[model samples]
Target: MLAKPAMAAIWVNQYTGEVMGKYDRPAVFKVASAAHRRLFGKSKAEGAFGAITGKLAIGITTIALLMIIISGLIVWRPSKGHVRNKFKISITKGTYKFLYDFHCVGGAVSALIITVCILTGLNWSFGWYRKLLYSTFGTEVAETTSHKTPAENFPAWDYAYSKLSSEYPDKEIRMYQNEADIVVGGCGNQQATDTYKINPANGEVSSVTTYEDKAESNHIKGWIYSLHVGSWLGWLTKIIYLVCVLIGAVLPITGYYLWIKRLILKKCHSA
Candidate 1:
């Protein structure tokens, strides 16, 4: 069930040139992202069923994973004399033993990585959590004024786009027009780094805010986002994160099997 969405996300990243430094995302990535929206919902905007489902899934899975890890640790307390054996797979003991060791040890090793992924995901899933995160970073969400603009007097898209793009040659600019202001967001190296507010009527730049110029907390927040998606350290960390996610995907299946096997063996012995 999760396989398709995971693969699609990886596919989108592949085309977006995340693995490489290039930003030339192909048309196919749009299709893949659409599929992602259909599966995970449109993440940025609200009111989509997919988005609601995705959030619910994240919350539930995070709790479930935490329980599993804690319970497993409690049940897996090895004697002091053989404590070291818990970390090693004993292939000589047979397939079942090897699998049991692998599942236990592998899960223990990957627990921290998976926990970080889950907590970060939850931060995006819940509003209160998001607020807390922003507060911890010494920033709050930007507030937009509800001022009105006459339709006939609205700013031209091309004019705003061109002006902002020319001003920030090194950054990719995306323009937004609302009743209150003409806002231009500038992204460099794949993350939004700056914002510009332009006067709609005269196309004059009124204010500029650079993310990097903000407090250290803001930088920490940005790093958290990059780390969540495994893009912080480039290809190497991405590969490691990919592996950890794959292990996370398989843990439930392996755990279920182990449980069922234990039940069967106990029944047979009792008989």
Candidate 2:
């Protein structure tokens, strides 16, 4: 889906963390965002605040996708001693045979990537699913925010950023003062961010939590985009994902045709 690829276009420099196009999203990204996450611009916030229906939609669609994949596998069960032929694609066949081969072969090939995409895509839409993923993977979701108010004076955000930026020159730094302290995050790869808590009054950096300090869930969350877009292994996986995703998109159309044709034939026979 366009949404999967669009999420990959965050445009952050891994070196400087210069978030390019932070204010302006391209037209494709906007359209995909509107369709996939925002329900074509119905939901207000992308997160936990606004859209109940979007979450429901994701959950329902994910279930349906699971069913589709399972049923496809069922239908694609290879005949005895013919597993090799089942994967062979031939355009020379008639339209029905070609479509059937394409559907089965494509589904079989891309099933793993589609499963990974579905699983990775779930965290954005459902908190419960996220929690289940975390717990199942032997991690607890911890709140990174502290509610206590900082000093009356605003935290020394500039000083903190300077301190972190110099220490980790290769990293991209983001800093903000929450209720409790000045929180600074420095990251090299997008996933492995180090978090620093600074004192508001003294501008002192108190604690630094590195990526290694994080749990498996945190690491997995960071890899979600890469895994979903099939970029984890560079172009090799991307090509595989591209083929599989396109096939996935086409499966429903072919499936619907078969279902309708079957119905028509049954009705004709009865008549």
**lDDT (C-alpha, whole model) for all candidates:** 0.61, 0.67
lDDT of 2 by residue, 181-201 (tens): 222222222344666767776
lDDT of 2: 0.67
lDDT per residue for candidate 1 within 1-271, as digits (tens), equals: 0122322222123224353322433657755664433444553323334567756666666768778877877777677898788889888988788788888888877777777776666665666876787787678743322222322223454466667667656655555452122222222122435656666676566786676565655555565667677776667768988888888778788888888999999999999
Those runs of model 2 whose alpha carbons end farther than 4 Å from true positions after fitting are 1-22, 41-48, 142-170, 177-190, 198-206, 224-226, 234-236, 263-271
Highest lDDT model number: 2
Model 1 segments more than 4 A misplaced = 1-54, 74-84, 135-192, 198-207, 215-221
Candidate 1 is scored at a TM of: 0.62
CA-only RMSD, every prediction: 9.1, 7.2
